[model samples]
Target: MKTAVILLPGLNRDRDMIAAITHISGEPPVTVWQTDTTIPDVDLIIVPGGFSYGDYLRCGAIAARMPFMKALKEKAAQGVKVIGVCNGFQILLEAGLLPGALMRNASLKFVCREVELEVSNASTAFTSGYSQGQIIRCPVAHHDGNYFVDDATLKTLQDDNRIAFRYANGTNPNGSIDNIAGILNAEGNVLGMMPHPENLIEHAHGGVDGRALFESALGLVAA
Candidate 1:
């Protein structure tokens, strides 16, 4: 699939994301700057993990208002797939592309390590490579990664099969409401997650579970 990575100031994991997508899809992803108001036509857009804008006001608060954020919303309306990892997920919430918020870790510490996720709804475009109830390990590096949503919203997500991934038993790195590690927007075209799937695409990273996501996107675009 044709992919582009959003490059924001203080974005830390841009190179890692670029490398992983290049390796998984066998195509290099272009990096688009935050200041840009327009994005190229592509099958997918990725907002990778990083401390955008130095995490001054919450995690992704500053970067969320950039012009590209608006462009992304437009692309989503056009049915272009969008994936946000870690801080990118926070931005999606701030931009109102997704519901809920990412709160600070319950421990209030920067959690950086590999975590296991139980695939909740594998039927979506992003998880077609995974199986329902499959557990995949991916690294997460962030300070504010706890996912939160009200009871009604949470129930709506559950009833709609929108929860993408949940932390494996006892693997909830942060105190996310319902241990939600990832979720899909109402249309299922947009995905926001805290874990860094791109980090797990390389064999050297100890697993290839993340490849399923990239492969799924490619397959979806091909379809």
Candidate 2:
């Protein structure tokens, strides 16, 4: 399957994400610069992790206004699959492609380490490779990873099965409500998560838990 990986200024993990896609799916994702006006022809799009715009106003606030994002929003509306990681997740929230906002960590510090994530909604294309309640290890590196949404919106997400991943084993690294680590949109085609699945794509990185995320996307395209 063809995938397009978008990179914004200050983006640091584009290569890591591209390697994960190439290794797991045997396809090298096309790297699109943030200034590009057109979204490439691909089955999937990934906004990789990084300190976009040096995290100036906010983590992803500036990057969200890039020309590429406008096209991304249009593709997303057409049901194309999109995955946003770390700062990418923040961009999604800034662009209104996903609900909720990522705030400064409750501890007010940058957190970088492996985290356990529980699969809450395996029915979505992003997490379908894992069974419900399955725990997977992925690395999270961010300062503003605290996810926040109003009670009413949180209730709506829960009702719609949009809460896809949560901190597992009762550990809330960033103090997100209900330990939410990731979520999907109502349509289940878009996913945004704080954890860096691309970092765990190889055993050399400590585990292969992230391989399934890319593999799952391949399965979705194949089906």
Candidate 3:
């Protein structure tokens, strides 16, 4: 499957995401710039983590208004798979692609460490590689990663089984609601999460637990 990576100024993890996709898929992903209004035909699009525009206005607030996001929204409407990590997750919420918002870390400080994540919903296209309730290690680095949603929305997420990954093993770095580390859109084509899966997709990163996500999204498996 063809994949594309969205590039924006100040997004430091774009290369990491590109490398992970290449290493796992055996092909380099195409990169799309923030100013570009058109994107190439691809099965998946990834918005990597970083402080775009110096995280001004709020995490991902400035970057979310870019022209590229309009194209992204259009693609999502077509049912193309999209994943946004860290600040990217914030952007997804700002762009209205996903529900809820990311707030300042409950500790009010930046957090960078490995945390365990539970596969809360393994039936989705992005998570079929793992079994439900499986635990995996993933790295997270962010300041405003806390996730919050109203009771009604939270109930809907629970009812629809859209919560993808939750912080497990008592490691709620950002103090996100329900320990939510990642979530899927109502249709299951879009995903937004704070953890950095790209950083842990290889053995050199200490484990290959994160590879299944890409494999699943790329249809390398029966996902």
Best by TM-score: 3
- Clash totals for all candidate models: 0, 0, 0
Give candidate 3's TM-score: 0.98
Query: What's the CA error at residue 142 for candidate 3, in Å?
Result: 0.7
TM-score, per-candidate, Cα-based? 0.97, 0.97, 0.98
Give the per-residue lDDT of model 2 (tens digit) for 1-223: 7999998889898899989888888878898889999988888999999999999998899999989998999899998999999999999999999999999999998999888999998888887788888999988899999999999999999899899899998667899997999999888889999999999878799898887787887684243
Candidate 2, number of clashes: 0
Best by lDDT: 3
lDDT of each: 0.90, 0.90, 0.94
Off by more than 4 A, model 1: 220-223
Superposition TM-score, candidate 1 onto the true structure: 0.97
User: 46 in model 1: Cα distance from truth in Å?
Assistant: 0.3
Q: Which scores better on lDDT, 1 or 3? A: 3
What lDDT score goes with residue 199 in model 2?
Answer: 91
lDDT of 2 at 191: 95
lDDT of 1: 0.90
Question: After aligning candidate 3 to the native by TM-score, how far in Å is the CA of 61 from where it should be?
Answer: 1.0
Residue-level lDDT for 53 in candidate 2 = 95
Measured by TM-score, how close is model 2 to the native structure?
Answer: 0.97
